[model samples]
Target: MPKAGRRRSAVWACFTENTASGKRRVLCLFCHHDLVANPIRMVRHIVRQCPNADEHHKKICREYQALTVPARRRPVVGGQATEAAKSADALELESARVHSDASAPPTE
Candidate 1:
């Protein structure tokens, strides 16, 4: 059973206890396929790969996947030079130019 406030996966509905293995394994209600009590495999089986799975089961499995999977961070473009670093470099260049101009004697 899940904790009082924690979210539970809807894909759990597709699982039934394996009578032979007891709690060690679960049987798929859709295709009667036996699987170990592994959440990743269960989700994959129900969501993307299960030919026997119905639309309802797939929908729930997708929901579970969405909750569990962390969104991928987009890769930084063009080597290093992040936006902050680029801005800082530009500011430094501007300040150096200004400092050089200020130090120089006034030209007529």
Candidate 2:
């Protein structure tokens, strides 16, 4: 499925494509390296994980990280994703959307 509105789109902005397994995926803006689409993708790429992340990724990462960083880490498998992380991210995105929707008038 497509993401929600602006809040989710910030995380989606890092994406390049989706896998056959129904997971939307992202490539490092600095290196075009592929990974699952999530906020931690920003944190991992901006921090220690991605060797190619640079200034561009840093700004995007920071923006998305503020919206979606989970409080804990999920086990990673060869840099691949798991369902738990996806669900947590979904929850975060939903939470952000609900909060925004309640606090502001509908844009259109």
Q: lDDT of each structure?
A: 0.79, 0.66
Pairs in steric clash, model 1 = none
User: Ten residues in a row with the worst lDDT in model 1?
Assistant: 80-89
Q: Where is model 2 poorest over a 10-residue stretch in terms of lDDT?
A: 7-16
Q: Model 2, residue 80: what's the lDDT? A: 63
TM-score of each: 0.55, 0.40
Candidate 1 residue-wise lDDT at 98 = 100
- Tens-place lDDT per residue, model 1, 16-101, is 87869656788888888888867767898888767789898788788878888886655557886555545667879979999999
lDDT of 1 at 50: 71
Q: What's the TM for model 1?
A: 0.55
